[model samples]
Target: MGRWEPNARGRLERAALDLYLERGFEQTTVAEIAGRAGLTERTFFRYFADKREVLFWGSAALQEHLVDAVAGAPDCLAPIDVIAGAVEVAGERMQERREGARRRQAVIVANAELRERELIKLANLSAALAGALRERGVDDPAASLAAEAGIAVFKIAFQRWIDDDDRDLTSLIRESFGDLKAVTAGT
Candidate 1:
């Protein structure tokens, strides 16, 4: 209850996720999360916009990483290849937060509002990805198509990674991309 909570942001995030998994996202409140973390309600607001934000606190940074990866890729690569590179980078980052990512995904799936938010977040990321591709001199449907396809592959790979923690996320993403290719090939 003291004013100096070391790692307050991390503590708040852990507290919020715990409360969310315990009481359901909609059933939980900022005050409850703050109290659980042994902090003030105001402290919760300082870290997140609301209880729902606790699940998405890292999304902005994720988006930045995705965009950076896309831009950082070699210019000679095709649009899809560039997208795959970005996806691989993002997948590797996800691996570092595997357990937390799994818990957060479960929480998102359990709440309709959170799920909607997640879709919106994905849409934003897709748009950002497309923009990043365009910046790389990619044109029109190619950029949009690659971005959309990348997101689809990412969704499947992320789900599979969460379903079983045995495999690295980057590998799962690669497998998911292969699955997409195979399915589209009608083979």
Candidate 2:
């Protein structure tokens, strides 16, 4: 059986973020992360492939939540409605992690490689959302459009949420969604 550490992953993530914030992302090394966590480099690797994986642990969970939400949305809802509901559900899960998320975002934004990884992650998520919409019988460009729009709203809402602690992600998501509709309806 594999060795079990109750909070190994969490410790590693915290340590990595702390190091990233102090020394910057590209400057932070895996050994330094492991040392800060009071664990070995081997233990760090046990939890993550490398240092970049440190900031991304919650992303996989968020994607799964979004996928589940879209898949389970009521059939009567439109595509955007389904996406909004999914975003709301995913947003709720992130409320408690806002501070950590903000810090992680700072690290990603400050580094080129991290930013590229983030773009790739978002693209994968958008594609997944589109595929889910297709499974719900949405047509070609419509599904792609709806998914990308939802992601754009999500991105805007996230920025607003991180900037203002009092801001609710779901409300921002809805407002941004409305903003998109209003802007597009004029054309």
Candidate 3:
């Protein structure tokens, strides 16, 4: 009800997720989300492109973080190791917001469109990582493969982390990466 609302972005995200969980993503509207957040539709637009973006607004930042991590990694590390470290750093950040991650994953899993969008985001992340590896002198195929594998490890670990409340995401990511290496090593 005031001209200046603190944390408008946070308020909008919370309202959108709550409405999506309550009424289903397809049934929720921007107007309803804005009303629930006690902000005008114009104010909501200032924070998010649309209602669906509320769930995915962090994708770009996450991608940037991963890319920067890989770029800053030591040259002695292998491509996969660089990716692993990057994702672990990301996991630590996500661990700080575990509940929000769980809720967002739930919303994405329940909707086909959202799941597709999630996949696209992952694909983009993988590509960005591969590019970073190439910048570090890693060749094709190896870079792409390592990047894809890293995303796979991150995805699996993220799912397991959300499902098991007792496990931390970084631990799960390490376990998943170890599993990947084991499978590749044929042992």
Q: Estimate each model's TM-score.
A: 0.95, 0.94, 0.97
Best by lDDT: 3
Each prediction's number of clashing residue pairs: 0, 0, 0
Q: List the residue pairs that clash in candidate 1.
A: none
Best-to-worst order by TM-score is 3, 1, 2
| lDDT computed for candidate 3 | 0.94
RMSD of 3: 1.3
**lDDT per residue as tens, model 1, 1-187:** 4476688898888888898899898888888888898989877777788787778878899899999999999878888888888999988877888888888988988989889999999999999999999999999898999999999999988988889969999999998888888998899
Can you tell me which runs of candidate 1 are displaced by over 4 Å? none
Q: Candidate 1, 93: how far from true, in Å?
A: 1.1
